[model samples]
Target: MRLRLLVALMGVGAALLCAMPAASYAQSCEMKLGAMGPMSGGAAQWGLAMKSAAELAAAEVNAQGGVKIDGKQCKVVVVPYDSKYTADGAAAGSNALAAEDIHLIIGPVGSPEATGIKPVAARNGQLAWNAAYAKNSLEPKFPLMFHIAPGPAVWADAVIKRAEKEFPMKSVALIAPNDQGGTDIVSVDAEAYKANGIKTSEEYYQRGTTDFAPIVTRILASNPDVVDTASSPPGDAGVIIKQLRLAGFKGPIGRLGGPGTAEILRVAGGLDVVKNFYWFETVPTEDPKVQEIDSLYKKLLGKDPVGGTAVWADLPAARMTLKAVSLAGTDNAKAVAAELRKMPVDDPNIGKGYWTGKKQFGIAQELSFPFGIGIIKDGKNLGVERQPARPD
Candidate 1:
């Protein structure tokens, strides 16, 4: 009777040992994803949006028992870095994250950061998505680099035409920081305006200059029918618009760059102060599906997402990257990039988009989503109108 009892106890111990491996395997597997952007400074909203998007995407995957890789589930961990909206900052951020064995990055929002991160990220075998309007936002040489959205070239003409219908303009002055971030977008904007039969003049200032009184005087001297804060950070644009109004310039203000209308309104003192305005919105923010993103973020992250529409625009890139990682069965940058190129550009919240940029960037790595043209006539918001995605 004693021998039989001992044998039964041994069999029970063996079964317990067999169950331990499955639990251990689940706990051991993890994937580290890097989120880089300017977490501070004037463009902080854009950067913060990128980080929030990455976090939300990770949370969604974690909810489903994490992402499947190599026949095991791996929990995705997002490591965020503040790249300071500068080229050097982004380059350093890439190397820093690479040291931690992170192979994918979701951010570095500005034009300078995009220019800064490409070569460094490539050398580190990292795949990075940038939401910059830089001329070189995507290039054939940087296979690992992808664009979050198309630059002004894709939608500038459509926006300009739409704005003309509401606010007629014969001449316009464009103001932005005197950097690649400003020049690349401003130059393209100028061409689009000219193409629409409007006269265009360009003005640029040092990025950190707070007092735009001098710049406002110069812009008003041009006596433009409309003044455009093309590609300026939302903070800088607000101050510029406030000064423009104070200096006795009463013309429609336009933004051909990024979206930050809510921030701009608060900074510029409100709708009454902004008066007539028109701009390019990266997404049709009024859509019920798009509005649901905030609720989803709150539910998953247990917090509100910052950066407004910018966060919604950045979410798809982060989600698709994780999907690619699962499809590749590894976090290897090259393998994941291969999968990304093959996958369709689709997002549940943002709906359908296209993979474009073959003609402009010589590579089809840019995500072209349905964008919107926003208008505010005489201090009352007229809302954003959805535009179809252009064919690649």
Candidate 2:
């Protein structure tokens, strides 16, 4: 019955993934793995979605006779942990996973959590597949650490360039948090806007502030051509959009990231407010691959996938880690790290990524990915006015 149930679940997972199961095997090996991230807090969606990506990729590896390491086929066993999106929580989760002899871990989403978890990983000689924004996480700082996502530069360049060509912005106003995250967003957007001939102004708010009216009003008073919300969480972004739309500010709404913000749409009661919004959209949900993983994610939640869930790019990073382990033939942190760096820059998730970052982080262990400017039309990422360009 357990076998039957697993089979049924796999079917559902694959159905949602809309792709063949890449996780396979005859249950020959048990390779213990770890997945740590935010699973029950403000950033839970990223973690939960990451878990789905990790599990599905692991399942695919398992289905494929598992990773052939140490002269045997090892079945993947991913032990997931919630980092609570905090430094302390990340440290605790990493220690717990390490205690269980898990040397390979994926996650603790943002740079803050990734930074907290790295020390524990180094102590245990563990391998980490991380998604981060901070420069310090790159090589030398943590040779075993690999950044699996693009920085704000990637998104900023894509969105602003396209917006400049089509929408032609002269001045823009922003509502952003007053923290390091906000700082990161401001810096990236400032450079992008400057290059595109767009002057920028901002109104800052502290984290967890419920009222946006005063800030929004202040922003509108600036009479900018565009309203940009840099680094706003999905929920907060929704509120900002609704408040702006309701308060009668109608210029293109934008950010330096991807779209598929179903949760934001739901919060705003729909996408009617987002008539002209541009983001770093990489996946069109209509694609079979996106639909597949998206379906798997929704099933895992036992509800609909949240805003931007379908567009999560870290999924393939987990797959990349597993594949690297299989090739290395050992789970040794150093060995796996070397093996992962040797991986080619190609995948369905997040597009082609690289192992470059020496100039920024004193090491070349960054996994940069490809993305393009995409606009939300009728609640979908309807291609780009301009495709993203490769960096020099």
Candidate 3:
């Protein structure tokens, strides 16, 4: 009886030992990162792209044994929130994510969301990167807020010059949503066009307006040489383009706003419909290194990334944020911000960039990368031309 009891006790001890590692692994360190944007609606592409970039970054870090936090390798888990491209939506999303103890956010992709998330994120001790072109995207008071890329103020003049050479225009009418997101970018674009000695007119419509026929009629009445969709969501821009064409306005169409050419093409009924188009491409996507981002995303995430060039533009921010988190040795937002500010603006895929925005935003937290100008002349895709980054 004593020998049998000893054997049973030994077996119990072995079972406990065998179960220990699995339990510990299950309870291992995990860092939750927040990714916010409009995951639905017309702006879904941009938001989804931000989420995809964050996931790819997290995957890349996890593959290398995860991020070292407090001496333990912590696996990153991305918690996404669809901000719905509104101010209140972003503010609420920040609070919701803060409740989950997530201190870093990948995006709130529009100007209104940027405006809304800033104060809430600051109060929550969160560091959020906003890809908004708002006039005040990064204020000195909100040091934790970071800009994903330089706004139109940085590249609009260059793009305008390139577009002017291709499609000479005397007067241009700019149309956008009647919100800060639209007004801010359109105002800057207007200035750029005016500076180029071109006459400019501004048109605004309420957000969520599907039919732009009335607005198109009003715009065509001016008989402008060009119509610039300055920062309208791609879906809205496509509809506007279609209506303008139907209204018998055959002038060149320019998009001096966000990068959404692919979506615009799909929504506007392809290249044939959007003939004589000129727009901005956030990166020199034609480069072999830049083009490699898609393959890398596929290899890391086991899926094709959406959002076209926007994903490539957003990836560096996510990658650098992870690097900062690892270096800071904590998920603390303030600590991560300090490390991020100190790190150089370098990405293997995007090449070198600058930490601009000191002059524009009163903070040097904006990433300025080499951009490109895409053209579709006479219904043929002319490809994107790479332009070097300008110094602040």
Candidate 4:
């Protein structure tokens, strides 16, 4: 029964994504925005998506004769770099961009990479609109570093609280990559799960791992009722699930951040094998306001919006940065970052509120964007459906 549901979800996710039209590009303009992410590594898809979205957004703004900052129409332009999923690479890319005389930075998609380049952003007096999740990564504080989403700690806590009520499993197992980002999130999950009186088992694997028989055997032996996977992109998660099924393990699995049903289905061959897997999905369903933004995105890019948690960050960060720059009446990153502290965002994803309270990096920079849960159900080889993630 569970397998059947997963197959159904796979189909749904694919249809929605494929339904999107190719992006129609708008006319180019002058204001340049530097964007960075892992463009040429195991996580390149993430960077590609970010690049595509940022470019599309910039084109849209540029088409309107650019953003009117202090009465001057500066056309939006985006410069992007591939961090190659490495901290060193990310830092180099950031410094290289800082030397280019640009004002704002968009990414460095993975958390570890984000940590590597954050200091560079601070030293050069630039704003880093982080697009990755690293629990406690932004703490002890660096100036000019702004996080748009809740960290992995928040996600771990959410999963624990939900699991306690929903699954009511006696023991849960966790599998995460040994990378800095994954380890950090696992730590968070362990702490939160233990605090909730949840028995836990854990195993760590290197990134780029495709075979999961050994891990699956270990997990089954541990006899965990629930498994939490802190992997991204959905592809790796798919591999893990398929191997689990092949190993004859029958337990629920949760994945973080992979809703592209096609990716999972293609790798798993069938949704039945992956029916028990779930992911923390962040995109909200069709809302009137989001639809309006989607229309605007389509109009400018000639493509439907590929909704993701990043869009919330990209759109609002762009807006905040632009507004601050306009209000400060200067292009200095320091001044603009300062002015951004006074700005308030009322987007549906970020919730209706202002960032007037605490500062992430000292008297400026606060969090935006809300985190939500999602589960995968009814999946096919190239299609999937994601319902809002509920407890358990």
Candidate 5:
């Protein structure tokens, strides 16, 4: 009887040991979020900023004992990948992240790169927060994908409306890359200019066409009062601006997106050379909240913030996603997406944004954040001149 009782006790001990790790798993798990972008190529500045922003968000959440999910505190970790700003690179980088079991992917910013991540993200059941300025970035092709930027119509109504009041847009020359990107950008410009009683002449140039002499001359012959570089790639936009300046068009240089200030300065030798240029993307760093973010970013990344990019929006986007994780009560993609649909426009960086997309993309996943206007003076970033004003 004694031996049999001892044998039974040993059996119970084995069962307890087996149950131990299964219980502990709830206490020691980490939720991995992935970020991919061009950390090495021309868009490195933007990419690095994105990665840093995610890291900052993750750090803050982890410090607070992580995002509570499944009745457990799952620490969020941001894993970054460099996509080289190419479609192939984005696919490969995202695949690598999926292999590591990362569920939420942030970035792969811009055009073809942002487009390529859709399939990989969908296949892996990963939620993607696309921070690109591309036309198709917010398309409903991927049910799990979300856009955190404003749309073309939103910009046209705000940026262009403000431009009409500030600059002489009666005769504006619009130039962009001869691609789908240009089409989307110019489409907004056309509608906005027309609404504001401004006439616009649009000219498209093929990518890699280095000679802007003829293009600039044709643009000048039209005698435009404002030159719009809405969809020109960074390097090309800078080249066009420098050439336009050389050709003596003393009008305002403008974009609905960032004008690639570093590249523009590099190509044009600005900072006491170039005059007025306006952009629609910048953080109102004067606000104390933005100032804190700015200081933290500089300290964490060992670099100062760059204007005229999505640097301001990326951190806000991350914070918004994390907020949904808490409100959804679980980290499940669809549940978090549902909560995201109801997220408020409280992020100070991107003012007064709400989640709305059903009318535009057949899904309620786009964050309509207010965009700020930036003015460049004496070739230096003057920061935001005005915030986006939405119609009632």
Candidate 6:
């Protein structure tokens, strides 16, 4: 009987041991988030900034004990890939990301690159937060692909409406690339200008058509009071601005998207040309919430911020995503995406006195955060001037 009791105790011990959970060697860190962009090519500046922003967000999240997903504390780790500013590369990277177990993916910086990844994002059950200006086709077709930037039409409408009040300009000349983003800006300009009784003089140029003298001569002949450049891709806009300056056309120029205006200011030899140029994208130092962000960014990056690029929005976007994921209690993509859709207009993360409208299918509510018309004055990047009357 004593031996039988001992054997019974041993069996119980074995059962207990078997029932206990095994020690997992797998890291309990947050599920990885993928970021794809041009980190190696001409657009490296934007891509590096994006990577920096994502890293900053990840650091902040990890410091706070990470985002909780499915009852586990999962640290957010950025898995960044450089697509080299090519469509085929972007598509392949996006496909690879779709195959990964990650729930969310952030970025393909350029609109063209973003375009390449859209289809893969739509079909693969992965959520993509694209850092590019809005395109119309993504909405009805690619519902899962979210844009973190304002739509081209909305941005253009705001610029034209504000221009009427700030500057007396009836005749406008538009110079844009032969791309979808540029074309969308032109389409929006046509409608907005028509509404405001302003005439639009159009100029369409290929991406690298460096010789803008002939075009500048014709644009000046039209005697435009304002020139709207929808050129992105950085280099193209820089060339256009230099040629325009050389042709002595000093009217107000509007940069619809990307780092064109800022790059022009850097290469134009002085801040003289920048003062006359207006950039419609969000700048890093514009809002108070960003002051803390800027402080941190400067601490890490050791440099000032640049405007007209989505890198400015990247960190904030990541923060928003992480916050929503934490609140939702899971890294489930659909759940997180739903929470993001309900983001409040008066979100504290945006800054003081800022408000956003209802979240759209294409963009996060934060992109609607007020934009500044940045200029380069005396060779220094200056913030907005002639600030619009804040909406009540």
lDDT by residue (tens digit), candidate 4, 1-392: 99999999999988976764322122322557777877664466566556655676576556545565555667677788888766887888888887787768777667778878888778877777665666534543566777554444445566555544434666678777777767766676677778777787778887777777788889888888877776544566667777877887777666643234445556776667776555554444334454366567677778765424345445666666666765776667888877876666555443453442143232325453444454444342211222232211
Pairing residues by index, what is the TM-score of model 3?
A: 0.93
> Please, what are the lDDT tens digits per residue for candidate 5 over residues 293-326?
7676666556665533456667777887787887
- For each candidate, the alpha-carbon lDDT, in order, equals 0.91, 0.69, 0.91, 0.62, 0.71, 0.64
Q: Where does candidate 4 stray beyond 4 Å?
A: 1-29, 68-71, 163-166, 256-266, 286-288, 291-295, 304-309, 348-364, 377-392
Residue 248, model 4: lDDT of 76
Compared with the true structure, model 6 gives a TM-score of 0.77
Kindly provide the TM-score of model 2 when superposed on the true structure, using C-alpha atoms: 0.82
Q: What ranges in model 5 sit over 4 Å off?
A: 1-27, 69-72, 133-135, 205-214, 259-267, 282-285, 298-309, 326-331, 348-351, 376-383, 388-392
Winner on TM-score (3 vs 5): 3
Residue pairs whose backbone atoms clash in candidate 5: none
* lDDT digits (tens) for residues 1-392 of candidate 2: 99999999999997976564434332656778888777764456667665766776676677667887887778888798988666677789888988888888878676567768888788888888666565465558577877666566656765677666656689988766665446666777777888877898877887666679998888778889988876665567778888988889878888773243666666666766677777664443444555577666555445444325433566767787888887889877788878887888677644555656766777666666555566665455465443432442
Give me the displacement of residue 313 in model 5, in angstroms: 1.2
- Residue 175 CA displacement from its true place in model 1, Å: 0.6
lDDT of 5 at 330: 77
lDDT of 1 by residue, 62-147 (tens): 77767778988888899999998899999999999999999999998999999999999999999999999998899889999999
* TM of each candidate vs. truth: 0.93, 0.82, 0.93, 0.78, 0.79, 0.77
Q: Distance (Å) between predicted and true CA of 20, model 2? A: 19
Q: How many residue pairs clash in each candidate at the backbone level?
A: 0, 20, 0, 27, 0, 3
Query: How does residue 318 of candidate 2 score in lDDT?
Result: 79
What TM-score should be assigned to candidate 4? Answer: 0.78
